[model samples]
Structures are given as C-alpha cells and as structure tokens.
Target: MTAVQPKPTPVGETFDSLNPATDEVVGTYAVHTADEVRAAVERARGAALWWEGLGYAGRAERLQRWKGVLTRRLPQLCQAVRDETGKPLRDAQLESVLAIEHISWAAKHARKVLGRQRRSTGLLMANQAATVEYRPLGVVGVIGPWNYPVYTPLGSITYALAAGNAVVFKPSEYTPGVGKWLVDAFAEIVPEQPVLQLITGFGETGGALVGAGVDKIAFTGSTATGKKIMAAAANTLTPVVIEAGGKDPLLVDVDADLDAAADATVWGAFSNSGQTCIGVERAYVHERVYDDFVAKVVEKTKDVRAGSDAAAQYGPVTMPSQLGVIRRHIADAVERGGKALVGGVDSVDDRYAQPTVLVDVPEDAEAVREETFGPTVTIAKVRDMDEAIEKANATKYGLGSTVFSKTRGVELASRLRAGMTSINAPLSFAGIASLPFGGVGESGFGRIHGPEGLREFSRPKAVARQRFTAPITLTSFHRRASADPMVARLVTFLHGKR
Candidate 1:
C-alpha cells in the first residue's frame, strides 16, 4: 500500500506536480521549510496590520481589482486547475466562476457583515451605549485541498482578505501550480504588501504553517489530518476552522420526483470523481419506489464516465494513491453481499475510476462506514423516512445532504443532521453565496461563505461607552443607606414575579 504520510523533505528541496492523466510534470515548486513558512507568516503578520488599516472600503477596492484580474485571466486559471487536477475544462471553469462569485460576494458583503453597529443597551444598563463589530485577526493561514484547488481555498482566502486579514496559503502539494497561479494573479493587482502569500510543499510544510504563529488557520482536508492540524495549532493556541470529510447522504421519498432524484443522485455522487467533501456517498430510497429509483439511477450512471478524453463527463483521479481505497471499498461491498448495479471492483484503473453503484451494502461495511473518496455510491431501501434518517445519521460525518420530496422537502431536510442540505436538488448549496458552508461531528466545525465566513477569520470587538452618569450610582463607591433598598426594590419591580 502507498504510504499516507507526508512526502520526505530535505532542506531547500523542490518537487514536481504531475498531471494525473498523463503523469507529465506540470509544474515544479520548492518544498518550503518550516523557517520559510514562519517567514511567510511573519510577513503576513505585518501585512495584516496594513491591510486592516485600509479599512473595508480600501480593501474592497483592492479585492475587486484582484477579482477583475482573475476574471480576465480566467482561461489560464482554469487551465492550471485542469493541469493540476485531472478535472474537465468545463468543471474547472465552473469552479472558477464560483470562486469569482465568492470573491465578489465577500468583497461586497464584508463591510456590511463586519462593520460596527449600535447595539441596544437594555434597561439594566440604560446609561451605557454599546456597539459591536468584527475585527481582523491578523494573519490567517489556509491549507487547501486538491480536489477543488480553486473554489475551496478561495472560500477562505477571499473572505479572510475581505475581512482585513492578510493570508498565508499552502495549497495541496498536488496542485501547487494552481496555487502559484492564484498568488501570482493577486500579486499583479495588490503588489504593495505580501497580503497573500503562497507556500508549496507536502504535509510537513502544512504542519509548519499551523504553528507559524498565524492568528488563525482555515483548513480543508480529511478528518485525520484535521485532527493533526488542530493538535499543531494548539501548540500556539492558534484558532482553526476545519472543513473536513463528509459521507453525506441523499434521501429519496416515495412522493419525490424519480427522474429528478436519479439525475441529482448520479451527479452529486460522481461529480469531481467523488472527490467532494459534500458529495453524496449514500442514497436512501423509500421502499414504495425503491426498484424504480434503483433502475433509474443505474441507467443514468451508465451514461456518466470517467476518463482522460474530452468526451468524458469527469476525468481521472487526481491522487493516484486513492485508486487503492476505491478498489478496496468496492471489493469489500461486493464481498459483503452487495450488488454492483454499475461498474464493479475492476472498474478502478491506475488513474481513473469509472462510476460504481452498489446496492444492499451492509451499513457497517467500509464503503458505507468510511469515506470512499471515489466515484462510487451505495443505495439502500428504507421502510420509511424514519429508517432513512436513522441510517443516514449512523455515520460519523454530517457535512452536506440532499432530499427529494414533493411534500416533505422542508420537513426531511430539517431533520437531516448536516451542515447544508439541498431540497429537490444536489450540491446546489455550494453555489449560493448567502449560505454558510461547513459541517459538524467528524465532518468538522466552523463555517465559510456568507456572514459566518466573514466572521470566521475575525474576532468580535464590543465597545461600551458611558453616555452619562447614572442617578442610581450602581457602580459608585459612595452610596447612601437607602440606595441598597432602592436598588433591591428596582430589581424586584423589574424582575420579581408578580
């Protein structure tokens, strides 16, 4: 088995990022050392002060300029993403558009979401005036994933920049080219400060970033790695927002749209070659229409393919080591008496994995219990929605889920134990800028996107001012004898039971 540990590093060493489809070296980057990471963070720490000094309007102007640069060079960015990750050009472009949208949203909404506002000083503190706002937390370090080399990291980087924090980003070693491209693009627009810096390397470099004294770290990766990040960040007491793993589910109700459910399930399960943290890994269909749903899903999945060719719906698996995990999951499911309605164990090749759909997989099997992280999904029949919800909630992860119900969409979606759930659709929540995205439990905590995202890289600063002296003199040392009884009477008058 391929080792899951970080690639070995020597001082001042460099590595090559290869294209998964052809094993061709796409880009070469230095494997930055701990000292280099620390230097980057220190630079960002200084830049953070300057960035925050610009206030919201100035930063928004710069961010808009950066966004414009990214928009104009969209083709190059998309091509870089395609080279690093073996996703289709269209998929890269789609994520590019979404990343740009987030950049625009964060730039436009940061001032409104984090700006100071007058807060009511309740009757108890009538003489005091209160105001609250979010302030930047200095440098923010982001460790991004390779699957979404653009959108996922931008979700954190853009929001952090808009919130007035300078960022130090360490993109996945597998996608360093895309990372370099992003940093280079930002440089052309905001060349004044190292407000956004890039460090390229494997896991050791990422661990260094965690303890580089950055105020906060936004990490998107696996749960096991998230735990390690939390541990490293704990050394400096650096806060973290971890966007980790997800074995999200999709529920198909008896009254739902079968064709729509089939289409959504297929797309959500296999898109990005199932490299999405919020991708649907499990499907629970109501017993009333189980057979029909399975047939439709199998039919739809047959048309979806994974290859390096232009005609394929998806491309090769970016991480070659993941092929073993996909194979194991498929083998385990079939051995456990599960039926493969589509591709089977042998479908996983050296680089690409064709879509695989398994039915009647045991709940405790690895395919259902662990994160497959491949173009594979499991479908099961549930006697009722209650059974479906119970089975869905059985996993340790709760990231993103989907529900298709003609009448109970809201009801079923509300009951799902996930961070974001789409009703009658799949993965639609990721496109809506106003929605907060993240997860609970093994999927991880904290949020990115919308107002919550802006606040994620910030610390709330609350201010209270004395409008005038109070007659009651509750805070004064010089109090008359009757003052105690007067205060007691006031408290009784306001809070005591009638």
Candidate 2:
C-alpha cells in the first residue's frame, strides 16, 4: 500500500463536503492553499525516490496488499462514493470493485510492461547492446472529477503508483471525502513514506498543484478547463494527461439486439445522472429497427427514476450549476423541433433530474454538439452503418463509443475515432484492464489503464552498452571512409531485397 502524506499544515476556514442528494453536510475538510500544495509536492518528491527504489516486484507486492485493503473495505468506499456523487449503491459498488481489478492488474503487469528490457539494435548499430526502461517521473499530480470519483482518478493513481511515482491527488471539491478516505486507508500499510497525498480545495487549488513542479499532471474534467490546465502546466513545462468531457455516441445496426441496445442506452445515459465521461449521450439507430429501438428505450427509461431514495437508479446532479446546463439542453432541444418521448425541460428539479429522452433533435443543437452531462439522450435514425459512423464521429470529442450489431459490431467500432469502442457493451473498454482508456481532439490526450496507463506516468530511458567495437569506427576524427561503405552495405542487406 502507498503511504499517505499527512495533511498539509492547516489553511483557511475549512469547508464541508455536501451530499448532492439533499445538500446535507457529509464531512468537513481543509481548503488547501497554494503553500500546502507546494509542501505536499515536496513531500511526494521524497516518497517517490523511496518508491522508485523498491523496484517492480516490491511495488507490486505493496499494490496487491492495497488491493486487498480496498476489497475488504469495498462497502465503506462505495458508500462514500454514493454519498458524494448521488449515484446508486449498486453502481458505486461496481465502480469500486472495478477499481480493485485495475489495481490488481496494474501491479501484476507493471513489471513486464515498464521494467528494464533488452532491445535489438538496428543493423547499423548491431555491435552495441541496447535496452529500454521506463523510469518514474517523480511526483504526479492528479486532478480528479466528481463523477465516478473512485474509479476515474484511481485509473490514473493506481497506474502511477505501480510505476513507482508518488502522487498528490486533488479530487473534485464535491467528492473530497472519498479522496480522504482512500488516502487514510493506504496510510495504514505504508507508515514510513508519504507516497499518496491529498490536497483538497476548489479550482485554484487544482491550478496550484498543476504548476507546482510536479513531473506530470493527470486531470479529468471539462475540455474548457482542460485547455486552462494545459496552459497552466505549460508555464513549468510539466507534462499532463487530460481526460476531458465527451459526447459519446452509441450506434445500433439493423441486426442489433434491440432489447440489449435499449437496455444499455437507458443505463448508460442515465447512470450517475449521466455525468460519466464515457456515457452514451447520443444514439444513432439504423432505420430498419429505429422504431423498435426507440420504443424499448422509452420503456426502460420510464422504469428508472432519479431521486434521493435508495430505490432510485439515478441521482441528483453533484454540482448545482450542472442542473442549469441540463435544463438548457432539454429546453433547446425542445425549442428546435425535438420531441420529448418521455421527459422534457421541466424535468430538472432542485436536486434530481428525471430521465429525459429527446427525439427529433436537430443535429446542430447544443444537446448534440455540446456535452449534455445529464440523464438525457437524443435518438436519431440513420440510413446505414456508414451514416451511423459519420454521425458518431461528427463530434469534436472522441473519448468512447458503443456499437451494437451482430455482424458488424467489430467492423463499425474500428471506424470510430474514439480512444475506446465497446462492441455490444456500454463502457466495456474501461472494464477490460488491458485496453487503453482516453480520447483525442477536444476529449483530450494521454491514456490511463492498461500498459498505456503505466507508461503515462513514466519516462522512457534508453541505455546502450558496447559489446564489441565495430571493425570500421566512425565517431572520432579517425578514418571513417570504410565505415560509411560498411553502414551502406548493412542497410542494403536488411532492406534492399525486402
């Protein structure tokens, strides 16, 4: 288990984490100031050296033990996740367990993927032995989101830890308790080091950490904020990984299982109040089965309710301002010739947003172009898979997409430009511990989870050792006329006949 750096010396008036469901105060935490951010980074710098010295096997053992701790305390973590984000207990549990899987996988696989390994030198340099290894990049600063707080940040944090880097995580203000809980648990196993640290506050605190000379920053937030983060990190030339918002699309083909597609759409769009980065915001169905698919989706959407009660499948918006965005998206869609098959603009309540499914929305409306980050999905009919692909790739964000087609699921999924595409499954790419998770364009760059996740937190270091001197030397002011011909001969021997 990674060490938890003790909370930085206290700062301004502390803030209370509010339960999004009812606005009740759940826990009180310090509003970490800029000075605290720098202090934490300094502590992490020390811890990282120790962690890196542990090497691959030592870190892997500690990580597996940490996974054991998480598995044993799964319920406690899930409750914290639910209280902070207003997502259902089942969904929270699922995310917590999935995070455990990633922790286990990253620890078990990091040595193979990131440890020093020999590489063959090209023909020109065959006399030298070459090797490549990934080295920890000191302290890593992770700015996590309120939505899927446990799973999303852990995706970056676990990988970073497995790669032997100490972490300073600044979870979204809305879900700080969950962050504190995780840090505290890890502290039990690693008391000697400050390997995993938490600094709680709002946007300014996050910005402070980004510029605090950390080797890298892993941020999951809005694209607008991502741009701001990029600009901030640029000041110090700090590398960053941004998992920005997405308007992911779910495509259904003529031969798709309408029942399954409908079920996935309802859950994917409405889960976590549709606050997920990889959630299905748009559904493009082939014309052959459009009516059936829409009907099934409406039926499923009716059964899911958003509320503060235990029975509710969906929950309130974690951030209050997000309610206004949800309301506007529904209103704009309705105003622009879109028909509400179930919910409408008035569905946005003070706390909970009723499931809203808008059909016939214009392609250019905010609901389609911008991220609706709520439990609302727009359904459209396309002539064929080609048209579906076109509409799916139309958005600027390419984070994740879903395809449901018996014969063409794999083929069509390959065409989408997103980082991950799930065939017949919603967000399945995130669950597969080996696949990379992230996106391109406005959805942001850098990957988390899988081999890519471990590599993201590290810098490649290449080492070349001379085994035997070449017959024709060429480095010094010595004779190299013969060496040039020898190099040409090697290149021709390797590639001329190919």
Candidate 3:
C-alpha cells in the first residue's frame, strides 16, 4: 500500500495516475506545458463566443442534454473516480450525483439569475431607463483537487458554463481520468467547439493555466497552494475564486441528542477517509455531556474501517503523502497529553488511516491548530456553548462547521465563525443548491453554487437609456447657472433630513 512514484518522463511527456489502494497504474495523461495550456485557453476564447451566442435558452437546452449524458453514464464516471482516487464505488457515486445536481441547478437557474433586468431610474434620473445584467467573462480556467474530484470541481465548472463561458479544466494529477470523463461527456453534447476542455498535469500545469490569460481562474486545493495561485494570478491581475483547505469543526451542545451528535461526529470526521476539505477535523462538546458524547462517538467509530473493499466505510487516503501528515498530527496530539479515545498514530498506515479520536488535547497542539485532512478528530470539553463556539472559531480556517442542538441550533450556528454551519446536520449546506458555498479567511473567497455563484464567473454591465430631456440640464455644461442652486435645493429637500 506504499506510495508508488512514477518514473521520470521526458519533458512534455506523459505521466501515470496510480490507485492509492493498490499502487497500480489507472491511466496515463499528458503533462500539458504552458504553450499547450495557452492554446487551450485561446481555443476556449473562440468557443466562448459561440457558447454566448447560444443565448440562455439555447445554452440551457444544450446543458440539459449534457446533464442527460452525465446521468446515463454515471456508473462509468463513478468507476473512473474509484479507479483513480481509490474512493469506494458508493462514495464515488454520491460525488457524481452531487456534481450532477449542481450542473442541473446551474443550467435551470442561470437565465433567471443573469438575464437583464430593469431597474428604477431613481428621483435624480427619472428620465432615464436603467437596466443591469451579468455578462459572461469569456473563458475560465479551473484547477480542481483530487479529493471529491467530481463533485468539488463541477461546482465551478458547471456554474461557469451555465453563465455562457467556455472552460479549460485542469483536474488534479492524481485524478485526471475523472476529469477526462467529464470533459468527454460535455463534448458529447456540445461537439461544435471546445467549450469545455481538459488539461492534465501536476503543479506546473496548474501554474500554466493561471498564467494562460483565461478570463478568471477557479481553484480548489490546499491553502498554501491557493496562495501561490493567487500570487501568480496577481501578475496579470486575473480574478480568481479559490475554495481552499479547512480545519472545520463540529460542536456538540449539552442539550443535543447524544446519539445523533455522535453519529454526526463520526461521519463528519471520518467520511471519505477524512480527505474532504470541509470535513470535520475537530469537535467541541459541552462538559455536561462530554463523556457520554465521546463514548458514543467512540462506539460508532469502532466499526468504521478504511479500505478499498465495498464493505469498508471509507477508502484509503487519495494522496499517499497525506499519510505522514496524519501520523504527525496523531503523534503530536498524543505527545501533548491527549488520550487516544479510539485509534492512535498507528492507525495511519501506508495508504489508509483508521478513524482516530483523540481527547484532552491541548488547544495549541498541531492536531487542533492545523489541517490534518485525515480520518481523525480531536474532542475537547467546553464549559458552555459560548466556549464551544470560541474554541471552534479559534482557527484561521473558517470553512464549514456543524452544531448539534435542537432548540439552540440556529442561535449557536449564527455565532460560529465559519462560512456555512449545519444546525443539526453535517455538511447539509453543500447539498442545498441555492445556498452560496465559499469560506472567508484562509479557506478562500468567491462563492460557487447559488445566485452569487452564477455571478462569480460573469461581470455586471449596467445600461442607462435616456427616455426624455430632464427638467434640469445639470449633466450638460450649457445648463443655466440657476440649475446648480436648484439641484442643491432638491437634494436638501430629498435627503437632508435622512
């Protein structure tokens, strides 16, 4: 199960994608260079014109057809996802379903969200007809992550396409097969042009994409890598929407259903081998029920295993190097006087990490302060919900969080310093199509998945048409001298009191 390093290939050559659970070559993809990336972007620029020409209705029709292709061939896509990322087939299916949901939502709502709409001229310009609309930004470059390869990247790609823009996607080097599947599916429906293209490689390929002059870059990965992407995009001042890493927390209240809270803690912390960016990495439980909650979470996690088998609850870590990080965090927690409630540092093997729950860990421990990105959770006792919220918000990453309380759910959720909080459920906001998804601080900015998401890949254009001559010619230099005083008097009468 150890990591398998690919043999060196010549420049501009191809590389092999390996299965994490078996170190077997799943697929071979090209290492696209800067020139090739630029060529893809250039071709996308032309495709964007035709995509925009389709209009909202026409584009929606084509998108619907593409959705059909994805739906019908979901099993194939799921297999590809599993082969490349080592996620269970069911997990891969879930990821594909969520991605399809986003595609459907974006296609259905793009027109209503971005179409032109009339606006009030206001008292100062009553003679002008004002309107505002969102316009496509031409071409978008998406650098996707390996974990949840299908669901996460589609969040940006689907919305960008629905907004009448062509896209050039660079999936993670580990999961290029899944990316190719998606691009090939889109091409099946819209073969007239390269409206959606695929480019595969490692960091250099993604860097090339950032410098390829695409209208905007949408990236999802580690915060460190996100910073590099932002810095690179700064040179050309290209706008980017980054959905980065997170050390998300889950809080348990004194009044919460201990069983449900424990279930959420186990699932939120360990699901997908805890490779999820928004997965729960820490938990804060009220002291009143801390022992009982921890007991239940331990009981639940005992049966959760990670492997490549269908019966396994989760799969191996998609990226093998992450195993060392997981080991270090667990070891650090244990060394800092934390007690392993379930599994310990030994839980992290060469490929998969068993569910490890640690308690009594100091607040400053690496397990509590950093992103483990593994199937691990650090539970701490908090005196009250206030303390829980404070400890949860202590981290620099403000991504996703969960609050398990019946009566105080919304109130406590509102106080948590995260982008999105689930009152009684784990990661519920992500399933809702209308809610905007993105984080503040290091988790990255610029939303995807709602009306804001539709607007993210487009730019606003305002229009003002003169309906008739105004009674006061203040805008013209030939206006009468008395117009200045008249305008002053009108402004004072309209807004002076306010």
Measure candidate 1: CA RMSD.
2.2
lDDT (Cα, 0-100) at 396 in candidate 2: 95
Q: Residue pairs in steric clash, candidate 3?
A: none
* Model 2 score (lDDT): 0.90
Clashing residue pairs, backbone N/CA/C < 3 A, model 2: none
lDDT of 1 by residue, 395-456 (tens): 89999999999999999999989999999988999999889999999999999999999999
Following a full C-alpha superposition, what root-mean-square deviation does model 3 have from the true structure? 1.3
lDDT of 2 by residue, 249-362 (tens): 999999999999999999899998999889999999999999999999999888989876888887778877788899999999999999999989888876678999999999
Ordering by lDDT: 1, 3, 2
Model 3: how far is 442 from its true place, Å? 0.4
Pick by TM-score: 1 or 2, better one: 1
Instruction: Pick the TM-score winner.
Output: 3
Q: Which prediction has more favorable lDDT, 1 or 3?
A: 1
Q: Over the stretch 21-75, how does candidate 3's per-residue lDDT look in tens digits?
A: 7878888889998999999999998999999999999899998898899899888
Which residue window of length 10 is worst by lDDT in model 2?
1-10
